[model samples]
Target: MLDHVQIADAIAESLITNGVRTGTRLPTQKELGESYGAPRHSIRKALDLLEKRGVLGARQGSGTYVLGQLVDYQISSRTSYNHNVRRLDASPTIEFLELRTRQATPEIARGLGINRSARIFDLYVLRRSNGEPLCLARHYLSEDRFPTLSEHLEVATGISDLLRRIGMQDVRRSNSSISARMPAKHEAALLEIPQASPVLVLEGRNVDAKGVPVEISTSVWPASRIKVHV
Candidate 1:
């Protein structure tokens, strides 16, 4: 089943069932090979074809994972990141930095499926593992859906946490794109990295349990330290 097509389909189905949306990361090719009894090279070919079909992606050191946002009732895996980190001898903290209203930019609007000038709810979150910055997230919400967005500031930091808080019980990501690029001067300063350092950029849009686009988020990670698992 590790051939070009079979393994790819297997991964796709597995992801779909697990609620691993697009732009989510998958297991490493080596892990896939081990799991499926294929050579790494063959596993890589399967991944290559999946990526071509917009179903898989590799994020530098983060290993291979899903490629785009989440799809339908594909219930995401019931994994608790906070618990996992604590089990790994670390703590998790979600800092409720702040939220505001802003007009979406041309790029933001396009991803959010809105007019380029639509106003949206903007959120800033700092996710720390063991009290060290692990992921910095900026989320954009279709304000029309959650007019009371600002009132939900004290919720957890993880994306799933926020989704649950909004009563979006079945929210799932349908597409996401993860890329790495040199950090901007400001981002570099904030992440405590050199300007030349590259940061991992993740773009994700999630649909509600009803499959309506309700949230879009772009997260930045300092490439040197983060281990991204989609």
Candidate 2:
């Protein structure tokens, strides 16, 4: 016997096992229903569940399809644009506009999981997705962890890969705190959106497989362009 959610999980499993890329047209609802021994409504319910997870898409006249592009994610557990985009072989370029060593103020300390006055790497970046401006981000990393961040500025493209080179394999295990608000003037300018556009702000630390904070990231994105798939 199988529950509906399990059935949906099976569909997800099948999609992965079959190499279904994003944008693959899914089986029609009738086809799915017949194959699963379920009714169309039940099949639709499963598909809807997948849609909300940023895994599927619906079109007005074209039925349902696979959502190929990875969504900006915020599960209660973890999320990162770097890990998200890799599902499609896309990579984010980090402009690395600034990287400085600074004394951690109270706010910075809390954000970086460090004691007050500790030295930290303050990093500013522009994150681009497929060559379009996606976010403006700031990162704070305690100097004890990322030792040479201050002396170098070579990271004009991609942080996750760079981290892997530095021996951090799992960039997705990071703790994330997220919120949404209307864009501030500065944020609007940086992100190139209208002042009225809502922006989602994400702040968190990228934890290594050992659960250490490897990268601290803050990101902002216009509401109209993103869907939270958690």
Q: Give the candidate number with the greatest lDDT.
A: 2
* Local accuracy of candidate 2 as per-residue lDDT tens digits, 5-83: 7667778767755545556788898998888888877888888777654467799998888763324444544555666
What are the lDDT scores of the predictions, listed in order?
0.67, 0.68
lDDT of 2 at 8: 76
Residue-level lDDT for 136 in candidate 2: 82
The 10 consecutive residues of candidate 2 with the worst lDDT sum are 68-77
The local distance difference test score of model 2 is 0.68
Q: Weakest 10 consecutive residues, lDDT, candidate 1?
A: 69-78
Q: What is the lDDT of residue 74 in candidate 2?
A: 44
lDDT of 1 by residue, 170-224 (tens): 7666777779988777766655555665677877778766667778787787654
Model 1 stretches astray by more than 4 angstroms: 1-87, 155-157
| Cα-based lDDT at residue 206, candidate 1 | 80
